[model samples]
Target: MTKRIRRLTAALLAAALLAGCGGSDSGSNTASYDAVAEESLALASGGTESALLPDTATGESAQKIIYRADLYMESTDFDAAQDTLLDAVDAAGAWLEYSYQSGSAKEQDRRVEYTVRVPVENYSAFLEQAGQAGSVLNLSENAEDVTSEYIDVDARITSLEAQRDRLNELAAQAETTADLLEIENQLSNVQYQLESYTQQMRALEGKITYSTVDISLEEVAVLTPTGVTFGARLADAFGGGWRMFVDFVQGLVLTLVYLWPLLVIAAVVVGVVLVQRRKHPRPPKPPKPGKKAPAPPAQYGLPDAPAANAPPQSGKPDAPKNPDAPQDAPAAPAETPEPPKPKY
Candidate 1:
């Protein structure tokens, strides 16, 4: 009984080993845990080797990203900028892909553009250098991660290769020519699929290793009025000023022509004022200094003049009887003094 139990254990171990050998090739890229768990389950159930999907890869392989950039820029000198771009491309181990130019050198809006494929490691460096060649108007960059597609393609190729091996084995065992032909046809179809997958993977790898760049260049020159020189501008300023002065005089004359009736009314008013001033001229003011005026004649009906032969009164002059009377009105008479009061 002890020997029989030992033999049973050895047989079971041999079966598990055989299953591992069969699954190992298909599961080589799979995670270790999945492979181990699958093997254990197959061992317990006494099943044949199980083909596995790529284990849910918790850890990713190296990233595969296709990078692209677009740059738009203006240059002071298009020729020089183009030359600098080429040199920068070579320096960064990149290659020019395409270029185009529109318009003649004599045209103001002439444009030039370039495209390049730069090494992945040098992508940023090359981009910075390209921008330095001119004034960068716009820069855009994109990254497309091809890692999932890349892995899937790789996995598909692995599956196809395994299938091709089985087809080849079956072809080798064919007995008749018709059977061999059928197997060859199937093998050919499988080969074609594998080749297609391989080509796709190769393209993805190429793009991952090298990034693409598109640069558009334009030539710009400072713009001014038709005549650009300082001397021309100064001459224009002086001419404009003279023209403005002439326009001002013309406008003034035109305004007066349009308002002629109003102007005439104003002129007549001024003329009337001057005529009235002349017609009603005022008297001259008396002299201010040094003259004595004559006394008014007496109002008591006294003789304005003494008799020419009459003797003159001596001592003080006689006082007028009506001193406060208006010079032009006569006053009441007063009697003369009686002879001189009889002298006694």
Candidate 2:
């Protein structure tokens, strides 16, 4: 009886070992537990097991999703087109984190730059609607594949998990605390490595799930009054110059008009002052009678009066020696007297 009980115990131990071997070898202990639970549930439900089963995955994977696009559209009114494009993005439940626009009416062109994010499932549908925002001029898109990297991370995670599990089993069979501590330390390192792999896989999956798109718009040139001909522009410039000249002439004339009255008043005052000065002319004093003028000297060409000191001329009876001259001849008187005496 003792030999039979020992045989039963050995056989049960072998069966448990085989079941654990069939579980996943992935670095994730959670995956291993899930497989074991699934098989146990299947057996309890009386489901027949298959002879051959596919090999289970025992690792994490990595992936990256990246792409770019270029789009073009046209519209008569720039503002309207811009509004419609914005509306489309909102309706698609997407967000544009960056955008820019610049252009001129002459060129009939406007450009926009956008960095956007949309739901992974809605990327294709949103792009189709965006195409109708205006006239489509050009379109191109591309995506990069990273399936190989995903499988690589999965394989690494599997190896780390198996190492960690083996260390746990060793620590359970340890004879002392020191031996158990050593095994635990190695297990910690393996678990940390496994966790690192998991984080990397999640990141890759996120990138592959999202897509990016870029778009541009072109404006149509239209006729407007602001776009005048060369001749019309020249005429406008000349008109401005003429207006300035006319204003300057009018200012000069106004100044002269204001000064005319002042000039007339000054002239009248000057004339009145000159007339008053002339009317009060000074009178001349009469000449006084001075000493009579001396008579003119005798003429040089005529005879002049004789001097007082001059002798008497011989033409007159000579007042001869006597002051008083006898009346007859004295000699004749003496001879007549002698003759009368003789006759008596």
Candidate 3:
């Protein structure tokens, strides 16, 4: 009985080994077949093996370029130019991402700016059409190539997706709770990385597909010349000076208009002052110093009056003293004159 059990055990072990070998071989064959199918699909789509592989020197793809432009222009008629710009944008099937306007019509300094997004196919045509909106003062264009970056991001995304799929498969096949949890954690990390790279790829594609244009539009009475000749420069200088002067005058007028209330108040104050002055006129000024007044005119024919107590004139003969005049010689002693009293 012991010998029979030993033989049976050996047979069971050999069967188990054969089954394991067969399963491994089948899995490898399936993997090889999938790889071949993928390669065939890539070839059918005009892609090479190198293109399917990352970090290979033989693969080449279309260039991914981001285009940007800046345009500064001036228009004689702001309304017309704005219409033209809108029409151009509509014709090009472009949209305005941003728009802003500054200054006012009264100042003749109205300005409008636009940020536009246009398809790559319509970039040149849109630029040409936009130039007609006004006389271009400045134009600049730039292009950035993102082919390498695009390829790198795409490859990384593909790698992360593959890693996530492998981790999911491992999680499903995991026998222990600990192994399953670890695989799930790894899968989550791979998923997060995939999402981030996918977003970057989409952003790159958007920039590559659409071109950006920054347009500045200014309202002006006259178009600036593009010439660099001495005469043109001189004319531009004079024109600029004239425009400045006109702007200053306009600003001054606007300032006055804004302060009309204050001006009215000042006028009312002045009127009140004048009315008060008229009601109470100032007194006349005093005579100036160092000027003497004229004396009163002399009488025409007035006789001279004799002085009181005057003696006989020296030139004329005197009358003899009479006896009555001798009575005054013995006049009593003259009394002292009394002091004058103070007057109220």
Candidate 4:
């Protein structure tokens, strides 16, 4: 009887050991390197082997793509063109995402920049229309294929959700506080990952649904396509000249601003020269001759002045008179005596 009892005990112990080995071999382990195996483990732990995920893997998950464009253009009338573009956007069922306007030279030029979001169906047509809003100086288009990345994210979210469910199950079964706390920490991490992935997916979907376009509008004093109305022409005729003059003045000021260094050098050189001049002064110049002395008082009465070209003298070789000969009336006494006798 004792031997039979021992044999029964040994058989029972062997059966129990075989059952434990079989269970360990058949059970799914989340720690497995294979992703599918890990997911199976999680499903087992969560007791939700048939749990369903959202319809991300269906038609809703088309080839994920991001579309964008950049447009630089000139407008005839800034305000009018902007209004026209806005109206067109409404017509096309697009929305203005944002806008900005600034000036490189407020007096000369300004720039208007904006971002618009349009349905993918209307994206190309909207670009064409917006391009016509003005003379397109620049047009650029871009495309990004994110299908692979999106798939990756979606799979990650699904896995994380499964993990969270399994962790929740573990938490419920946890006997000790430490075990519960560890499970909660893992749940938190999984939840965080799920949230981040969901946000990214939403953003990507938004981009796919509505293509983005960045536009830059420029306002310039000239080269606009606006018509020349009589009034506008007249105003422009005058205003153009005025603006040109203003530009000239502005350019002059800018030139001065830029050339200040040259001007300063010139000024210093001039100052140095002036200082040197003051230190060593120049001598005064001598006076100049005024006029020739008047001709010697008319020669003592000659009956008449000789002509410059008159023949020199009658051929008589007269004797030269002495320079000391008396010039006073000669022999006046002899003549007076004769005249007194004739009168008596």
Give me the candidate number with maximum TM-score: 3
What tens digits encode model 4's per-residue C-alpha lDDT throughout 1-344? Answer: 33332332233223222222211121122112123433443343353432422223323446878899999877656777677678778978999899887655545456688899999889888988887777776789999987766665555556556556655765677667765665576567667767877787788789989999999887655553445468766875786598678778989999999999999999999999999999999887545678665565776667776899998888789899898998767664554444455563
Error of 3 at 316 (Å): 69
Ranking by lDDT: 3, 1, 4, 2
User: For model 2, how does the per-residue alpha-carbon lDDT over 143-207 read when each residue is reduced to its tens digit?
Assistant: 77666555545544554555455456556676667655655665666566678777877776766
The C-alpha lDDT values of all candidates are: 0.68, 0.59, 0.70, 0.65
Ranking by TM-score: 3, 4, 1, 2
lDDT of 1 by residue, 1-344 (tens): 33332332333333233323322232244344345544543554354433422344435578779999999887768789878888899899998778888755865456777779899999999998988888786799999987666765666566556546755665676666766676676667667777877887788888999899999887767422443589866975785597568669989999999999999999999999999999999897876689776676678967577788989878898876897776776866997776555555
Candidate that beats the other on lDDT, 3 or 4, i.e. the better one: 3
Q: How well is each residue in 1-344 modelled by candidate 3, as lDDT tens digits?
A: 33332332233223222222321122234334334434543444334321332232215578889999999999989999999999989998999999999778987789899999999999999999999988998999999987766765665555455445545555566667766665565556656667777888899998999899999999987777776679877987897698789889989999999999999999999999999999999997765888776665768798665698878568768877887564645768889999999999
Q: Which window of 10 residues has the lowest lDDT sum in candidate 4?
A: 22-31
Residue 38 lDDT in model 2?
38
For every candidate in turn, the CA RMSD to the true structure comes to 26.4, 35.3, 21.7, 22.2
Q: Lowest-lDDT window of 10 residues in candidate 1?
A: 18-27
For model 1, the superposed segments whose C-alpha errors exceed 4 Å read: 1-59, 223-344
The pairs that clash in candidate 4 are none
For model 1, which pairs clash?
none
lDDT of 3 at 160: 50
Candidate 2: give its CA RMSD in angstroms.
35.3
